[model samples]
Target: MNSPPHPPRQALPTHGTTLTPQAFRTLQAMALGGLLVLVLGWFYSPLRIWSNLLVVAYYLVTLALGGALFLALTYVTGAGWHVAFRRIPEAMASLVPKTGIAILVVLALRMNQYGWQLHAGAPEGTDAGTYWFKQLWLDPPFWMARAAIYVLLWSVLALSLVAFSRRQDRLNPQELPRAIGSMKWSVRLSALFLVVYSITFSLASVDWIMALEPMWFSTMWGVYQFAGMIQATLAAIVIVGLLLRRPGRLLYGIFRTDHLHDLGKLLLGFSCFWMYIWFSQFMLIWYTNIPEETSYYIARMHGPWGPVVLVSVLLNWIIPFFVLLPKPCKRSEHVMMKVAVVVLIGRWVDLTVMVFPSTVGKLPVLGIWEISGACCMIGIFGLLFFKALTKSAPAPKNDPYYGESLSYHCS
Candidate 1:
């Protein structure tokens, strides 16, 4: 027999969600305490502190950028399922400007650590590839200018897309035509943003991370970074979605398990993609057996760093792939949250593996310096995210597809 009609439900909340006073204080303490430790460590080991700062700052930037990329993608593809909890990604993207500034500061202080920056001149017998890279591409002023351009362009586009969404929220139902027009413009802007973002973000991966080991270059480095960004970003969305699903919360009745399942699917897909890119790069380099190319892997794959790499793979791919394979695991709040936490931690470790070996060249250590720096960044991220979350309605109400989003379900 067919089911009877259900009663009408209460409307979604109009206002944004706020952080409790105690929660605000906790994040404040975490940020400050971590800063104090980093400052104290700077006196004792400035290089270590700088390295950690660079890693964490880059991590922060990628997370925010990933959020923007997510928005641009969904908008361009006309994906409406995310409309119900779109504010989470918007809040996440709003951190781009703040994190952009953070990254510039770190780059100013630490760009010298890159091998290209330290080389006064290419030595005799330098290959044509290395020569051009050093002379044309690695010019410090040009590099900095490019970095500035990337940051400025991305900040404008990210914030503009966000502004467009917020503007749509003010329109009444009678203004349906205007909302549709706005979405059309959004589609155009998002398409432009993606074209720009793909090129810039790829170059960014080369300039920021790959350049650290100046002599070692992988053609797929950009793809590798992109995969990790999406994987971690999806994990972050899941965590935030679950948090907002708490009783009396903004997304209490809005963000559903079906949505979580979709996020989990993306998480699993990207984890596999990340591994594929990683293996492709590693396998190609190994097959070629080029000394310069092999040196990068040698540094990371041998000695103390070997175990770290193993753990990173396990956390980033092995664990998530298996855990999320089962359908129920993806739909369970506790299960999804734990996996998201694992992916986030794995992202940090994966970045650490990429950075530390190039800078410190020592065994991996999650000592006071690394731990505190992470605490500081995580705290800052939380504070900014919640602040952005409270700036508008917890869920977008004027998005043309908002109704469809509310009724979204998996078959």
Candidate 2:
């Protein structure tokens, strides 16, 4: 017999169902495929291998660092606009372990490609500035340790948040304070993480990209990486969100237009933020016309590097500027998705700009290694994301604002 209807519940959840077998299969394929590609690049070829390695390595780091930051921000601000999407960030955070592993592998492989890391380049002048110029902080062991430390810090925070979120799902509402407290600590941990993440990323830029020239340096390089990390991570978030909310599904409204609107605004914010840093770094160096500083852009302007520089600027700033400048476009999920794709590609090209100068040296040998390695990173992203899908309830069961998020609509 049917039971009588009861009073309406305020926060009933819809994500108790676990992952499907198909999802598991997909995850396995991605992990296996990514490893295969990475191994192929590592062994088969020399040309563009480092390029591929850089692309994959940076993204893995990008996802983890960005994941940690997103979770921390949600905790810091306590915004309900994100309730529907929080699970995915948790999912992204869960992938930090794999990212950590990938990054470690990338550093190991760099021994062959990166000469500066092994020893300081011989200076060629009367002064240390003239001689040691680029090698100041671009040496090997230090670069190696810093990269390792970045992942280590990121993993700790990631695991912490994922653990607490899982606890929140299993326990009663009264347990929220503990979870929230854990979240608060995650934010504090992230604050310290950001400082190190920044220095480390700069050192990485110096280690991986700046070392290519072994002469060029940009203080804003860290900010540039941070901007791309935010942009790319958001793109990853949107892509995952789009898939999760596809057609009919239990955890729907996770990628609503309003959410897309907020995401678009974030994309726009980072676009502008990148430009500010880009211009600030460029103008000061340009104004002074410092032989040391101006050389970096000069190489990027003349040959094959020229196209990458132009393409990067156009895609990251120009296209997004026009497409996202209007309120209408930001509110439309379709438009933002398109914009996000380009923004992501532009960033990859920006990495190319960073890598090609030293590694490829205008040869443009984007050979098998590069293609395969990029595919590998993509595959890893897929695998980790898929695996994460199974680990958590699709939605938080009793978040206070679940209803608000469910009914959230664009004005």
Candidate 3:
């Protein structure tokens, strides 16, 4: 018996096309405007400004980290369907080290404000020695060192893979053996990065965000962060893919309904996964009725933050779940783009719920601080990502799996 015929192959454009000059100028203006707003907001409400900073920084890092994870998973699994769109994630991954440094700068500036130092007093009935031990473990210097290590590891892995991939573009397509040989190191490094990422990302979540409430603890917190990261990252990828598919764009003709459908499925699945993690964390804490853990919920469940929490759920899961269920929605580029936008905004709200209650407390205020901070970070991300995209072919022309990816289709 013979194998089934592949879908018709499509022509891919060569590299060198860049973002329009007008587009670059617009993005640069947004970046500067956002920075100005953040600066002005800082003078009015320092606490709110700082909280927004943390939220934005962490959100950017998750995006970059998600990109790395996407690449690693595809490489390890030998997935070929995404080879045409891999450059987007590669560019996103390259932003990781820069975002890490930005996060470190924020932490250094706000070192005195973290609540861990106050935990030295120990709770009633708790042993002082144990409390002090925990405090020592969370020492600011050690926390900073771990963050640097995570960034260093991610930077090395992402840059190495990109270097090898770009080098392939310059090689002769007939050198199939050399092409395969070039990708072998990426596979090996991806495997290693996956292991390192699982451990370090979890620890980083605990150290950076969870540590805000030094008294509260959740075993599921890391998973919660990871789930949200994946959802947001998928939404971002879909959005970028759509944008690049426009006429005269670098990625035109490369992405098809099948690729969009596959991406949509992942987006749908991860949206539910994020909700599951969210509910599990909430249920376990609510049922156990532990004051320490419950306090974390109490801060958000009451007052102004409560409504935002509900909206976050609806935007992130409920809407996307129902909307993407139909076959048509997933396959349609316009429909998926709308869903992706909602999920992206939902992700910002989710991150807000996580950081604001701990930092700003009962006074859940959203003003120039939140808006400016988000705009600034997003503007920076756009600038860096588009810059990276211009550095190489938007699609991997010489990839071993490029032909298969171009010809991929659903039954």
Give one digit per residue, the lDDT tens place, for model 2 in 1-411: 221232233433455333456975765675576557656655665546656776777777777668777876776566678777778878888877777777678677765466553254454432355455434454566557766776677787678866766666776776755656655665676566556556766666566556666656677777777887787888777767766665444345444667767777888888888877877987998899877678888777777777778888998888888899888888766787788788878878888777777666765555555666666666667766766776777776556655566555555
Clashing pairs in 3: none
- What would you estimate as the lDDT of candidate 3? 0.84
Consecutive 10-residue window with the lowest summed lDDT within model 2: 1-10
Better of 2 and 3 by lDDT: 3
At residue 403, what lDDT does model 3 achieve? 80
| Candidate 1 vs candidate 3, TM-score winner | 1
Residue-pair clashes per candidate, as listed?
0, 1, 0
Q: Candidate 2 at 154: error in angstroms?
A: 1.6
Candidate 2 C-alpha error for residue 187, in Å? 4.1
The candidate 3 region of ten consecutive residues with least summed lDDT is 1-10
State the lDDT of candidate 1 residue by residue for 108-211, as single tens digits. 88666665543666654447655775667867788888999999999999999899999998988798779889998888889998999999999988988898
Better of 2 and 3 by TM-score: 3
Q: lDDT of each prediction vs. the true structure?
A: 0.86, 0.69, 0.84
Please identify which of the two predictions, 1 or 3, would achieve the higher lDDT against the true structure: 1
